[model samples]
Target: MDQLETMTCSRCGGSGHFSYNQIHGTRCYGCNGTGKKYTKRGAAAAKFLSDLRSIPAEQFKVGDLILYQGISHSKFVRITSVEVSRAKDQGCYSGDGEYQQVKIQCEGGYGAYYRPGNLVRKGCGAEMKSEQLRQALAFQATLTKNGTPRKRAT
Candidate 1:
């Protein structure tokens, strides 16, 4: 296998082959029996998927450093308390995203009731590579294999 393009199968120890072979073993589940290796894209997708599922700093526990928006860049603040309550989205797109209110109090004698879905963790945005898996998933659902966006019904 070409290292620059694809990886060698590790699951079957590169023994599995696309064609019949007497000495080598059959392909394993890692690469669908064709090869036991994961493509570069597959590895990248795994990384992005993990980033997508992981909680924001494990739900921002007390004493956790947070970078709040509506504040200066990277001006970290410590979390003092966290609570949840019923609240509407406080933005122009008031009807979108999570509606449950998340109240966070900082140790600096200040508090902010950030709008749900407005609190974006670092590397968690449309333009971020950390969201590449999500972008791929969304695109697969909304686009065709030939690189054309699918059309919706009228």
Candidate 2:
């Protein structure tokens, strides 16, 4: 994934405030008072789909743990079956318009359908790697003893 460039607020010049009507403004609406903005267009969903497509359908197997994030919810489920077929009709957003679909049986016998790429193989180190990255980012946001932000992990 490419890192998004940080842009300074043009109006505030990196300051969170600007003079308006001869009064100090509370925040810069342009950057939401952060004084920095992401320069790239937010295409996270597209990136995720691309990453998922890179994994072949043959890689999935029954009894394998997988992560599925739907429009309303997310879950780690056990794969009950894998079917490779063309999509008959558009029903819901299952990550892509691809024909391949995987039938997953979650806890309590609840069944759901999804694209194979929408499911991330659990215990394949992918989940752990993302979790570690999240923790590292959170840790970096914490204040240090000197009241300064901690340096981000390399």
Candidate 3:
């Protein structure tokens, strides 16, 4: 899991400035009038890290907490199976349905997992390295080299 590089300020908890001199009704310039510096990793970055860990189905199991990509929040889900079901239209923005579909139960809330390719589709400002796909394919080689599990968390 990736740790937040910076934390919210303790004094004002990242309000970015503080209102001081109450009698004069003035703000504090020392703290930038909002009292806290923005964290290096803000809410969006935090959410992105959380989403990375919540990539869903690390290991297929029953009643595991499942998460679908392109959805809002850490929506918990109960899983039934993790095996590939059939080749279905993934509705990918890349217009490529090359990947196989792994069917899952909704278990109440939204249960749609967006294809990773959609990250490029939305112009999300993230680019995968050319070697990333190759490394993913050669997982055993990566594990041998790193000798550490590539753990992701939400």
Q: Assess each prediction's global lDDT (C-alpha) against the native.
A: 0.55, 0.55, 0.43
Please rank every candidate by lDDT, starting with the best.
2, 1, 3
**lDDT for each residue of candidate 1 in 48-132, tens digit (9 for 90 to 100):** 4545544443266677656665644444577889777766555744556437766878776756665456533432334664346
Predicted candidate 3 versus true structure: per-residue lDDT over 119-138, tens digit per residue: 21110122542233233334
Clash pairs of candidate 3?
Answer: 16-34, 16-35, 17-33, 17-34, 17-35, 18-33, 18-34, 18-35, 53-153
Candidate 2 vs candidate 3: which has greater lDDT? 2
List TM-score per model, in order. 0.34, 0.35, 0.35
Error of 2 at 22 (Å): 34
Error of 1 at 10 (Å): 42
lDDT of 2 by residue, 15-52 (tens): 87765543436677777688986433322322333353
Give the clash count for model 2: 0
Candidates 1 and 2, the one with greater TM-score: 2
